[model samples]
Target: MPYFSRLQERPKIISKLYSNVITFLTYIVTPVLLFVILFAEEIVIVLFDTSYSNIAVLIQILSVLGLLKSFSNIGGNVLIALGKFKVGFYWNLIWSLVLTLTLLVSLQYNINLTEFTLVVFFANFASFFVWHGIILKYINIPYINLTLRFSLVFVLSFLFVYLLKSFIMFWPSQWPQSIMLGTYFSLLVLVTAYFTLLLLKNQKTIIFTLWK
Candidate 1:
């Protein structure tokens, strides 16, 4: 009977784990897609032959912002999972406040849209880290270990993408826009595939044990 109970619980455990994973992925992807869409105009302007100084500044700001946002997302998910509903709500509220304040300050200083957006991004990122810390504390999880693992994956994937982009830069200037876009996407796909394979290889031993 005890063995049967354990067997019965396995399906439920698996189902819940699957659901949480799906929810987390959805949360991460949706905001990213929305951010891209919302900033499309700024992105297009930057992509064209614009002032490299401003573009460089914008990129630097946005990159840090992006990192922060990613951290926040993971932190938020952890908070929700740990059953700290009030803490999560307050964290989100604080994030909104930070965004609003940053926007106001940026406007006051006459910052460009791209720069302003980057400020917003960093603000959100900070909020996410704060919330993440809170969630980890609540759940008694090791924050350093998880953060280092994610950082390793992120850096590796970014290097792959950077190299692919550099290679694309050497293509003919007269290449059709469609071709350029296709090449860009193909490279992205290849990078993703490479990363996926890397992840699988890294986890192979654990996966084999589970299957056996």
Candidate 2:
């Protein structure tokens, strides 16, 4: 947000911007992540081919990067907005170097997808926290609330998506016959359930204009 540009000049507004960012991450990205995690195998089956099912586990691990990189993305913007652009630049440079080194080292060994993904996840997650630490000196992030709320919503969203996936997998002959049908029904259930939960929590704030 452009408002972040003046954060140093107007420190008090930082909290409002941080709050909105957290809400956007919590309400929106978390659901997508939940979908990726719960249905990674089926999603993998559909997206590429059934042969790539092995990568679904990799995708599940990589899905955590959604939340991590969300913070990193916002932190990059904060650094640029605060006129500390080089910090963001150099930090990313280091991450790239580490990734390259990891890949090079792995080439010599027989690293599985899960093990490789774990390495990358730590690299990205550590960089995310480092970037956020630099930004926290300027921005007033609700660390505890953001963590607790996001974690709670993540579990709830995962359970919701898991239930839908389970029904699609184990239900009777009503199971969708084609991928197109299955996708449509999955989206229908997902969007409806997610918005319903949001509405039950905060109808006035979250569910407004959802139809529009």
Candidate 3:
């Protein structure tokens, strides 16, 4: 973003820019991840086989981690651009330690895939806030505002996905042959439409940001 070059001269504008970027990214990312979570079973079955369907729940858990990592990736770049390398380093260090220790403990207990992924998710989630705190010191990110935006996206996507899933459940099972396969494509199209509508609504801002 051009705003990256002007951070020192205009902190307030940069803060607003950060807010916009975060909001844009949240909208772009949350629905995709939620879709994966909701349709993981069908996704696994299609891509692999029914035997691999057992790992669908594990994929759902990891999708949450993927969301956190995406946010962290942006924050890391911002921190490096702002010359806060040490802060990023410590955040990563803590994250690594927690993840390693958890994995070690889980290994000893012979943890199942879902439980093991939950441990990994919690570790990453713990560090996610720490990274945000570091960014707040440098950029004044609107935490409350971002939280509300994220919650809205999550809730809306969940409702949208579930309602569609419920609707598809009533369809004749033999028509599609595999009910999950039908549900998968239906949800995929619905999510694509939802994302397209969001893009249209924000097209002006997106164009301005891109051209700037």
TM-score for each candidate, following the candidate numbering:
0.59, 0.77, 0.81
Can you rank all candidates by lDDT, best first? 3, 2, 1
Q: How many clashes in each structure?
A: 2, 0, 0
Which candidate wins on lDDT? Answer: 3
TM-score of 1: 0.59
Candidate 3 is scored at a TM of: 0.81
Candidate 3 weakest lDDT stretch, 10 residues = 172-181
Q: What is candidate 3's lDDT per residue for 1-212, written digit by digit as tens?
A: 43465465666656665666677777777877887888788778778889999999899989989988877677765666576778878877887887788899888998887888888888778778877887888877778977997898889878877765666567635553256555565766676667756764765443355566
Would you list the C-alpha lDDT of every candidate in the order shown?
0.51, 0.70, 0.74
Q: For model 3, what is the C-alpha lDDT against the true structure? A: 0.74
Model 3: lDDT of residue 53: 90
- True lDDT of residue 136, candidate 1: 50
State in Å the error of residue 154, model 2. Answer: 0.8
Identify the runs in model 3 with alpha carbons over 4 angstroms from their true place: 1-6, 173-207
- Top candidate (TM-score): 3
Worst 10 residues of 2 by lDDT: 203-212
Residue range 87-150, candidate 1, lDDT tens digits: 8788678767877877887899888777677667666666665765675565545446555655
lDDT per residue, candidate 2, 96-166, as tens digits? 89889977797678887688778788877776776677778766777887788778877777777777777
